[model samples]
Target: MVRRVGESVEARLDAERERIALWLPVALGAGIAAWFALPTRTHWIGLLLVLGAGALAGLLIGWQRRFGRAVVVGCAVMALGLLLVWGRALWVSAPVLALPVVTEFSASVESVEPLPAKDQVRLIVRPLKRPDLPPRLRITAAGEQGKGIAPGEAIGLRARLMPPPTASLPGGYDFAQRAWFDRIGAVGTVLGDIGRAPGAGDGVQTLRARLSDHIHGQIDGSAGGIAAALVAGDRGAISEADEEAMRRSGLAHLLSISGLHVTAVVTFAMLIAMSLLALSRRLALAGYVLPLAAAVAALAGGGYTLLAGAEVPTLRSFIAALLVLIAFLLGREALTLRLVAAGALIVLIWRPESLAGPSFQLSFAAITAIVALHESRAMQRFMARREEPWVFRLGRGVAGLVITGLAVEVALAPIALFHFHKAGLYGALANVVAIPLTTFVIMPAEALALLFDSVGLGAPFWWVAEQALNGLIWLAHSVAEAPGAVATLPVFPPWGFGLAIFGGIWLLLWRTRWRWAGAVPLVLGMAVLLAQPRPDVLITGDGKHIAAAQPDGSYALLRERAGDYVRDAVAEAAGIDAPLAALTDLDHVACNRDFCRWTQDGRTILAARGRDRIEGADMAAACAAADVVISERWLPRECAGRWLTIDRDTLPQTGGLALYLGERPRAVTALGAGDEHMWRRPPQVSGNDEAVPTTSLAR
Candidate 1:
């Protein structure tokens, strides 16, 4: 019986060998993820690459066992990925600013993005006179200060600048890492009058910028902004309210120039190319028009990508589209798992840091799941039926769209929740209308409008495009405003998210019944999320904001006027749906001019919000009396608490903290001890740092 079981297990493993190569990218991504997970930098590229090469050499030197070879090759690929990211990190390293600066400086503009709504233009400038500053800086200029600032122009201006900011909270968006990769060490805001902004932003000088400006000149309101986004990838003109609606309705993807937009542009280019080339009977008879059409489509799509800012998502889509066109020319199958993996590998090799971003995750996961579904036998059979009635074919197409949308949503749930703390409850249904409208109507019309503008016959097309965009905007707002449009749920912990992603990859890649095993981990991940508990108290890096849990199960803010970003972050972490309430409004907490004190479940939390209003000795006595103490200013050395005490001296190392209350209380911090990443600049401590609980801090 044991021999039979071993043979069955071997047979099952052997049957899954066809997809062994597909897991190579998964391994590569894992290696890159491991690099990011480390608290400090690793410079072992040569060692990792050597290990990978040695493994390959071992496989050639009489190591012929199939399972051993598979394991060796997987490890080898992972090592290569780690090596690539390590090298990339070193290549992109730049000095970051340590303090805020307010000085007049001159710089040559490298790029400009006009923002009509805010009456501002963002500039990426190369510093010419400031050797003390980083090589590059990203600054936002007012409409008056940036009246005609364009690329290639040298300009002088006074601005206040600061270093790229770290994450506002644990698992929150970290802009510092992105800035490091982009070589931007400072973010600045121009100092000027808040006068009327340039109307529709007419100062841009590049072709893409000019086109975007002209579109805004032609159309009005949010319609013009939508049109500009489609053509030039400038979203600054879009109103924040409309942008929020798009996000809430899950239609925001349409605003980004990704797969849908690229595919549409390529198809349109191919049709126009074939039509023009087919005018020659010689080309058609020689069977050369299709290949030429593919070439034309690739060129056109590449140009559009450059014009659209070449963001990560657009680049991914462009690379994928270019591959599909090449496959057409070579008479090879398109839309395979290998194709998806190839695109991902190229992206990872180009910018490994993108692996941590939501755009990269969402785009790749959506495409991978869609490709796997299409390649399934059931979907293939459904597509193969050719003798059906027109009605049946139409019905099948609609059903396929709905199914694909739903599948993509399911595949993205963990990632979405992990990042946003909410997912659209009815996004699949919303996309059924929005995708077609954007793809078949708005994009085509916009292209026509641009194509005809040289001959002055484009106004009609522009009008039609505007009307369609208005309808799309209306649909998004309606869906976003409806009841239960979004589901607020607890975001997954890092481990849970990793587990779900692993299971998803397993389910998608393996082409056998045993693939059902993947569902076990998926279920386990969901269970972890459902059982996760909310942190009882929250504090920001600056020690200016705090959130405490009240008896009524609501989160109350220490500051009555907390910004939306802080409030929402606290609310999400607390697993509450409502906005945060003012801590003063809670009856359990007692407040004075100096500090506030609250007692709950046999524990006391004392917070010092006003330093000028209290004496340090008195504050220390108050802290000693409470079980927990939180201070905005530096805590007195003798004021250690019964359970935990945190203040200005430790806030730099902690970055942010989330405290739990109970008999066995714990504290979780955003930044880990001894983290030496370029972005984390926690102050040095000479063995005097407070010792946080290892078990809680590890999480």
Candidate 2:
């Protein structure tokens, strides 16, 4: 019996070893491919680490019955590996920290978005980071500096061009985190008024603007015109309603020149080229013409896509399109899967952090799912029934739509919940209708608009395009505003994110029988996310109204001249909104009283300090015998005395103050709290009032 058991265990181990051997090479190849394609600041180390990790994972998982243990260990190892990758990401994406010396630089204004306030406009300035002059510096025109610049003007920029800022809000959308992966730093804006009219040439800027104008004129403010803008990656013309509708319907990706948009455009253009070439007499010429046409289309899309902020998915799609065309030109057999792997390997090597981002994860997952779906028996059955009947075709089309929708939806669902805390309930339906409209009607119209603009016949085309855009907008709005359009979800943990990713991977890889395993993580991720708690306090006000508590549990606000806005903001931030009225009920104007008095019914009284002249003397008297005296204004005049002045700026105009009353109630100690540790007293106060009494009885 013991010998039989030993043999069984050994057999299982051998089988596991065989499985590992089969998969290890593929994993290494993928990793090695990625290492080569990605750009690394510390090149050799990153390459070595990736290969070594791949090898380690392969060796560790070589035993068959140890699948569960191997998976657990592999996950732990990957988590550690990711930490190292993140560190490298930080170094490579170093933001420009120092200020730039602006000697001289010139750039033509591309476009501007006017902010709600008339005085400001968000200018997307393309400053020549490197100039002929020695004093010229690379500066980004983001945040405060990026505002108020206009198009067609060459304004000088003199400022620091540092790397992007770190994510300010923890667990929120980190623009800095994404920007670093993309190698974008802050660009400085013009220091003065527009100096010269930007010299015009027939570049992308000219073409894009002309095309946009022509479309606007053709559609005459129609929903279709806006749709054209969206399809062409020109979002400047889309109204707030259109934006809101797209967001709610989860079809905003259609307008964003992402993977779906780029792939659709490229695929359609390729099909047209292939069709035209197939009818040609010369086989050689036909082959060349088809590839050339596809190349031109890719370039066209690339130009527009870049102008519309080319994100990871758009870049990926463009690269994939070019690769496919190249493969055809080379007379290569259908090798799309290999090409996709190559692309992923290449992109991952360059930006390893990208693997962790929403764009890369969702796009790749969707593509993988599509590939797997096509390989399934369902797809084969549909292909066989193509010649059977119209009903078959109809059923197949619907199935295809459903399959594609489900794949993409599953891929992006995790990201959507994480970033927006909401899921588009009708997303599948919206994608089915809106995507076709944008791809076929809208994109083609945009291309025509560009031609019309070049020939100075832009207005007519713009008018016609606008009408179509309006119609699309109307449809989108109707769909988006429908009841149960979106549902909210709670935030998830890092582990939950991991589960979601694994779910996607499992669904994409497993043939059919074990594919159901993907749902385990998907469901778990959703469950984890929905269980998070909402923030109770929300603060929105200027600095002086209310000071935040320091590590030592003390808060400070301006004592002398406080406003209702500040008070309201503080109350909201502190999650004291419910008790706000009660705090005021005891004739207390502000909660920053020296002494706090509370009754059984939840009423609170703030006793006024001797030096501070509060709103109501009678109310102050009522709360005189208080549990604790928290100084609202400033540090006490005397540290060891009972006389407390709540006015800040009394000592020095530092910031705010916090006082922790010890066992000796009369012993006053000042806790300086604010941006700086300077004592500030209220300006309008007498010296005597501000002075501390040597000794005082319990009044």
Q: What TM-score do all the candidates reach, one by one?
A: 0.91, 0.62
Predicted structure with the largest TM-score when compared to the true one: 1
lDDT of model 2 at position 24: 28
lDDT tens digits, residue span 1-699, model 2: 955875664555455452333222234333432432334435435655664575466556454435534443444334344444545554554323232333334554556543221233345445443322212123334335444344555554433343233322223344444544444344444453333434522223444445454445455433533554465455655666567687778777665566666766677777777677667768445456666667766776677577555656677777776776678778784334556666775565455666656667556666766676676677767656546678878777876877677767767777766655566777777777777666776666666666677778756655555555666677778878888876654333556766776666656554435557788997887677666433211112111232332222222333334465444334323322121322223332444444333321122223333455445444344434444333434433232112333333442222222222334322111212231100011111111211322111101
lDDT of 1 by residue, 490-512 (tens): 43468888888888898999999
Please report, in order, the local distance difference test score of every candidate based on alpha carbons: 0.80, 0.49
| Pairs with backbone N, CA or C atoms under 3 Å apart (clashes), candidate 1 | none
TM-score (C-alpha, index-matched) for candidate 2: 0.62
Worst 10-residue stretch by lDDT in candidate 2? 677-686
User: Least accurate stretch of 10 residues (summed lDDT) in model 1?
Assistant: 689-698
Q: Candidate 2: where is the Cα deviation over 4 Å?
A: 1-154, 157-169, 179-206, 213-232, 275-280, 284-311, 326-339, 382-384, 387-392, 452-464, 538-699
